[model samples]
Target: MPVLSLAPRRSGFGTELLTQTVPYQLRGTTTLTFKPGGLQCTIELPAKELLQ
Candidate 1:
């Protein structure tokens, strides 16, 4: 299966972002620009190594 995308959930106020794996359906490969909690980071990871 191909790599899909990463949807990092934004934690509540004063809560630090948890480091966890968010699974998604493999549909080829797609790159998305995500900005959570006013912070931005690149979510580029291979499907086989989607683990954190």
Candidate 2:
């Protein structure tokens, strides 16, 4: 898979933004199924790992 594009912008929320290290987590299920043609998949983080 390839990333098409990314656009970053400042939130202007001040110092708190600079001091925090945000955890990366998945919000949905990542599924992989086998088929005759190929394997289909959906990538995402699991809810159990989202604890902050």
Candidate 3:
């Protein structure tokens, strides 16, 4: 997980105040399989999954 924050900008004339937050998008397929000895995990992702 991650967090993003926008800060205000300072100019010569005055200070511009700005506040915004954008969240990350996740797109994928996760699979978990159990075997005799151990556990196995697999993930399937698309080509344009992270284009957002």
Candidate 4:
């Protein structure tokens, strides 16, 4: 299994950025699936690691 971290950037003009951290597990397979949205993304991990 692996961990991921995300950081948000701040603007001097009073604007803020949105950020999030998502954790995923890696199994014996080697494929990563993700969906992208407006300023956000969703990721799916393998099955084997989920059982661990």
Best candidate (score: lDDT): 2
By TM-score, the best candidate is 3
lDDT of 1 by residue, 1-52 (tens): 4343554465553222222332243222333344443434344446665453
TM-score of each: 0.21, 0.30, 0.42, 0.26
lDDT of 3 by residue, 3-45 (tens): 3233223332211111111112345554545455443546555
Cα lDDT of candidate 4 equals 0.33
User: If ranked by lDDT, best first, what sequence of candidates would result?
Assistant: 2, 1, 3, 4
Model 2 TM-score relative to the real fold:
0.30
Instruction: Give the alpha-carbon lDDT of every model.
Output: 0.39, 0.42, 0.38, 0.33
Measured with C-alpha atoms, the lDDT of residue 7 in candidate 4 is 29
Compose the digit string of candidate 4's lDDT tens values, residues 1-52.
3333432343332121111222322422222222232223334555766677
Tens-digit lDDT string for candidate 2 (1-52): 5432432243345322332322222345444454555545545555566665
Model 1: what TM-score? Answer: 0.21
Instruction: Record all residue pairs in model 4 with backbone atoms less than 3 Å apart, i.e. clashing.
Output: none
For each candidate, how many residue pairs have backbone atoms clashing (under 3 Å)?
Answer: 0, 1, 0, 0
Error of 4 at 52 (Å): 1.9
Task: Name the runs in model 1 displaced over 4 angstroms.
Answer: 1-18, 23-37, 47-52
**What's the distance in Å from true for residue 38, model 4?**
3.0
Query: Which candidate would rank higher by lDDT, 1 or 3?
Result: 1
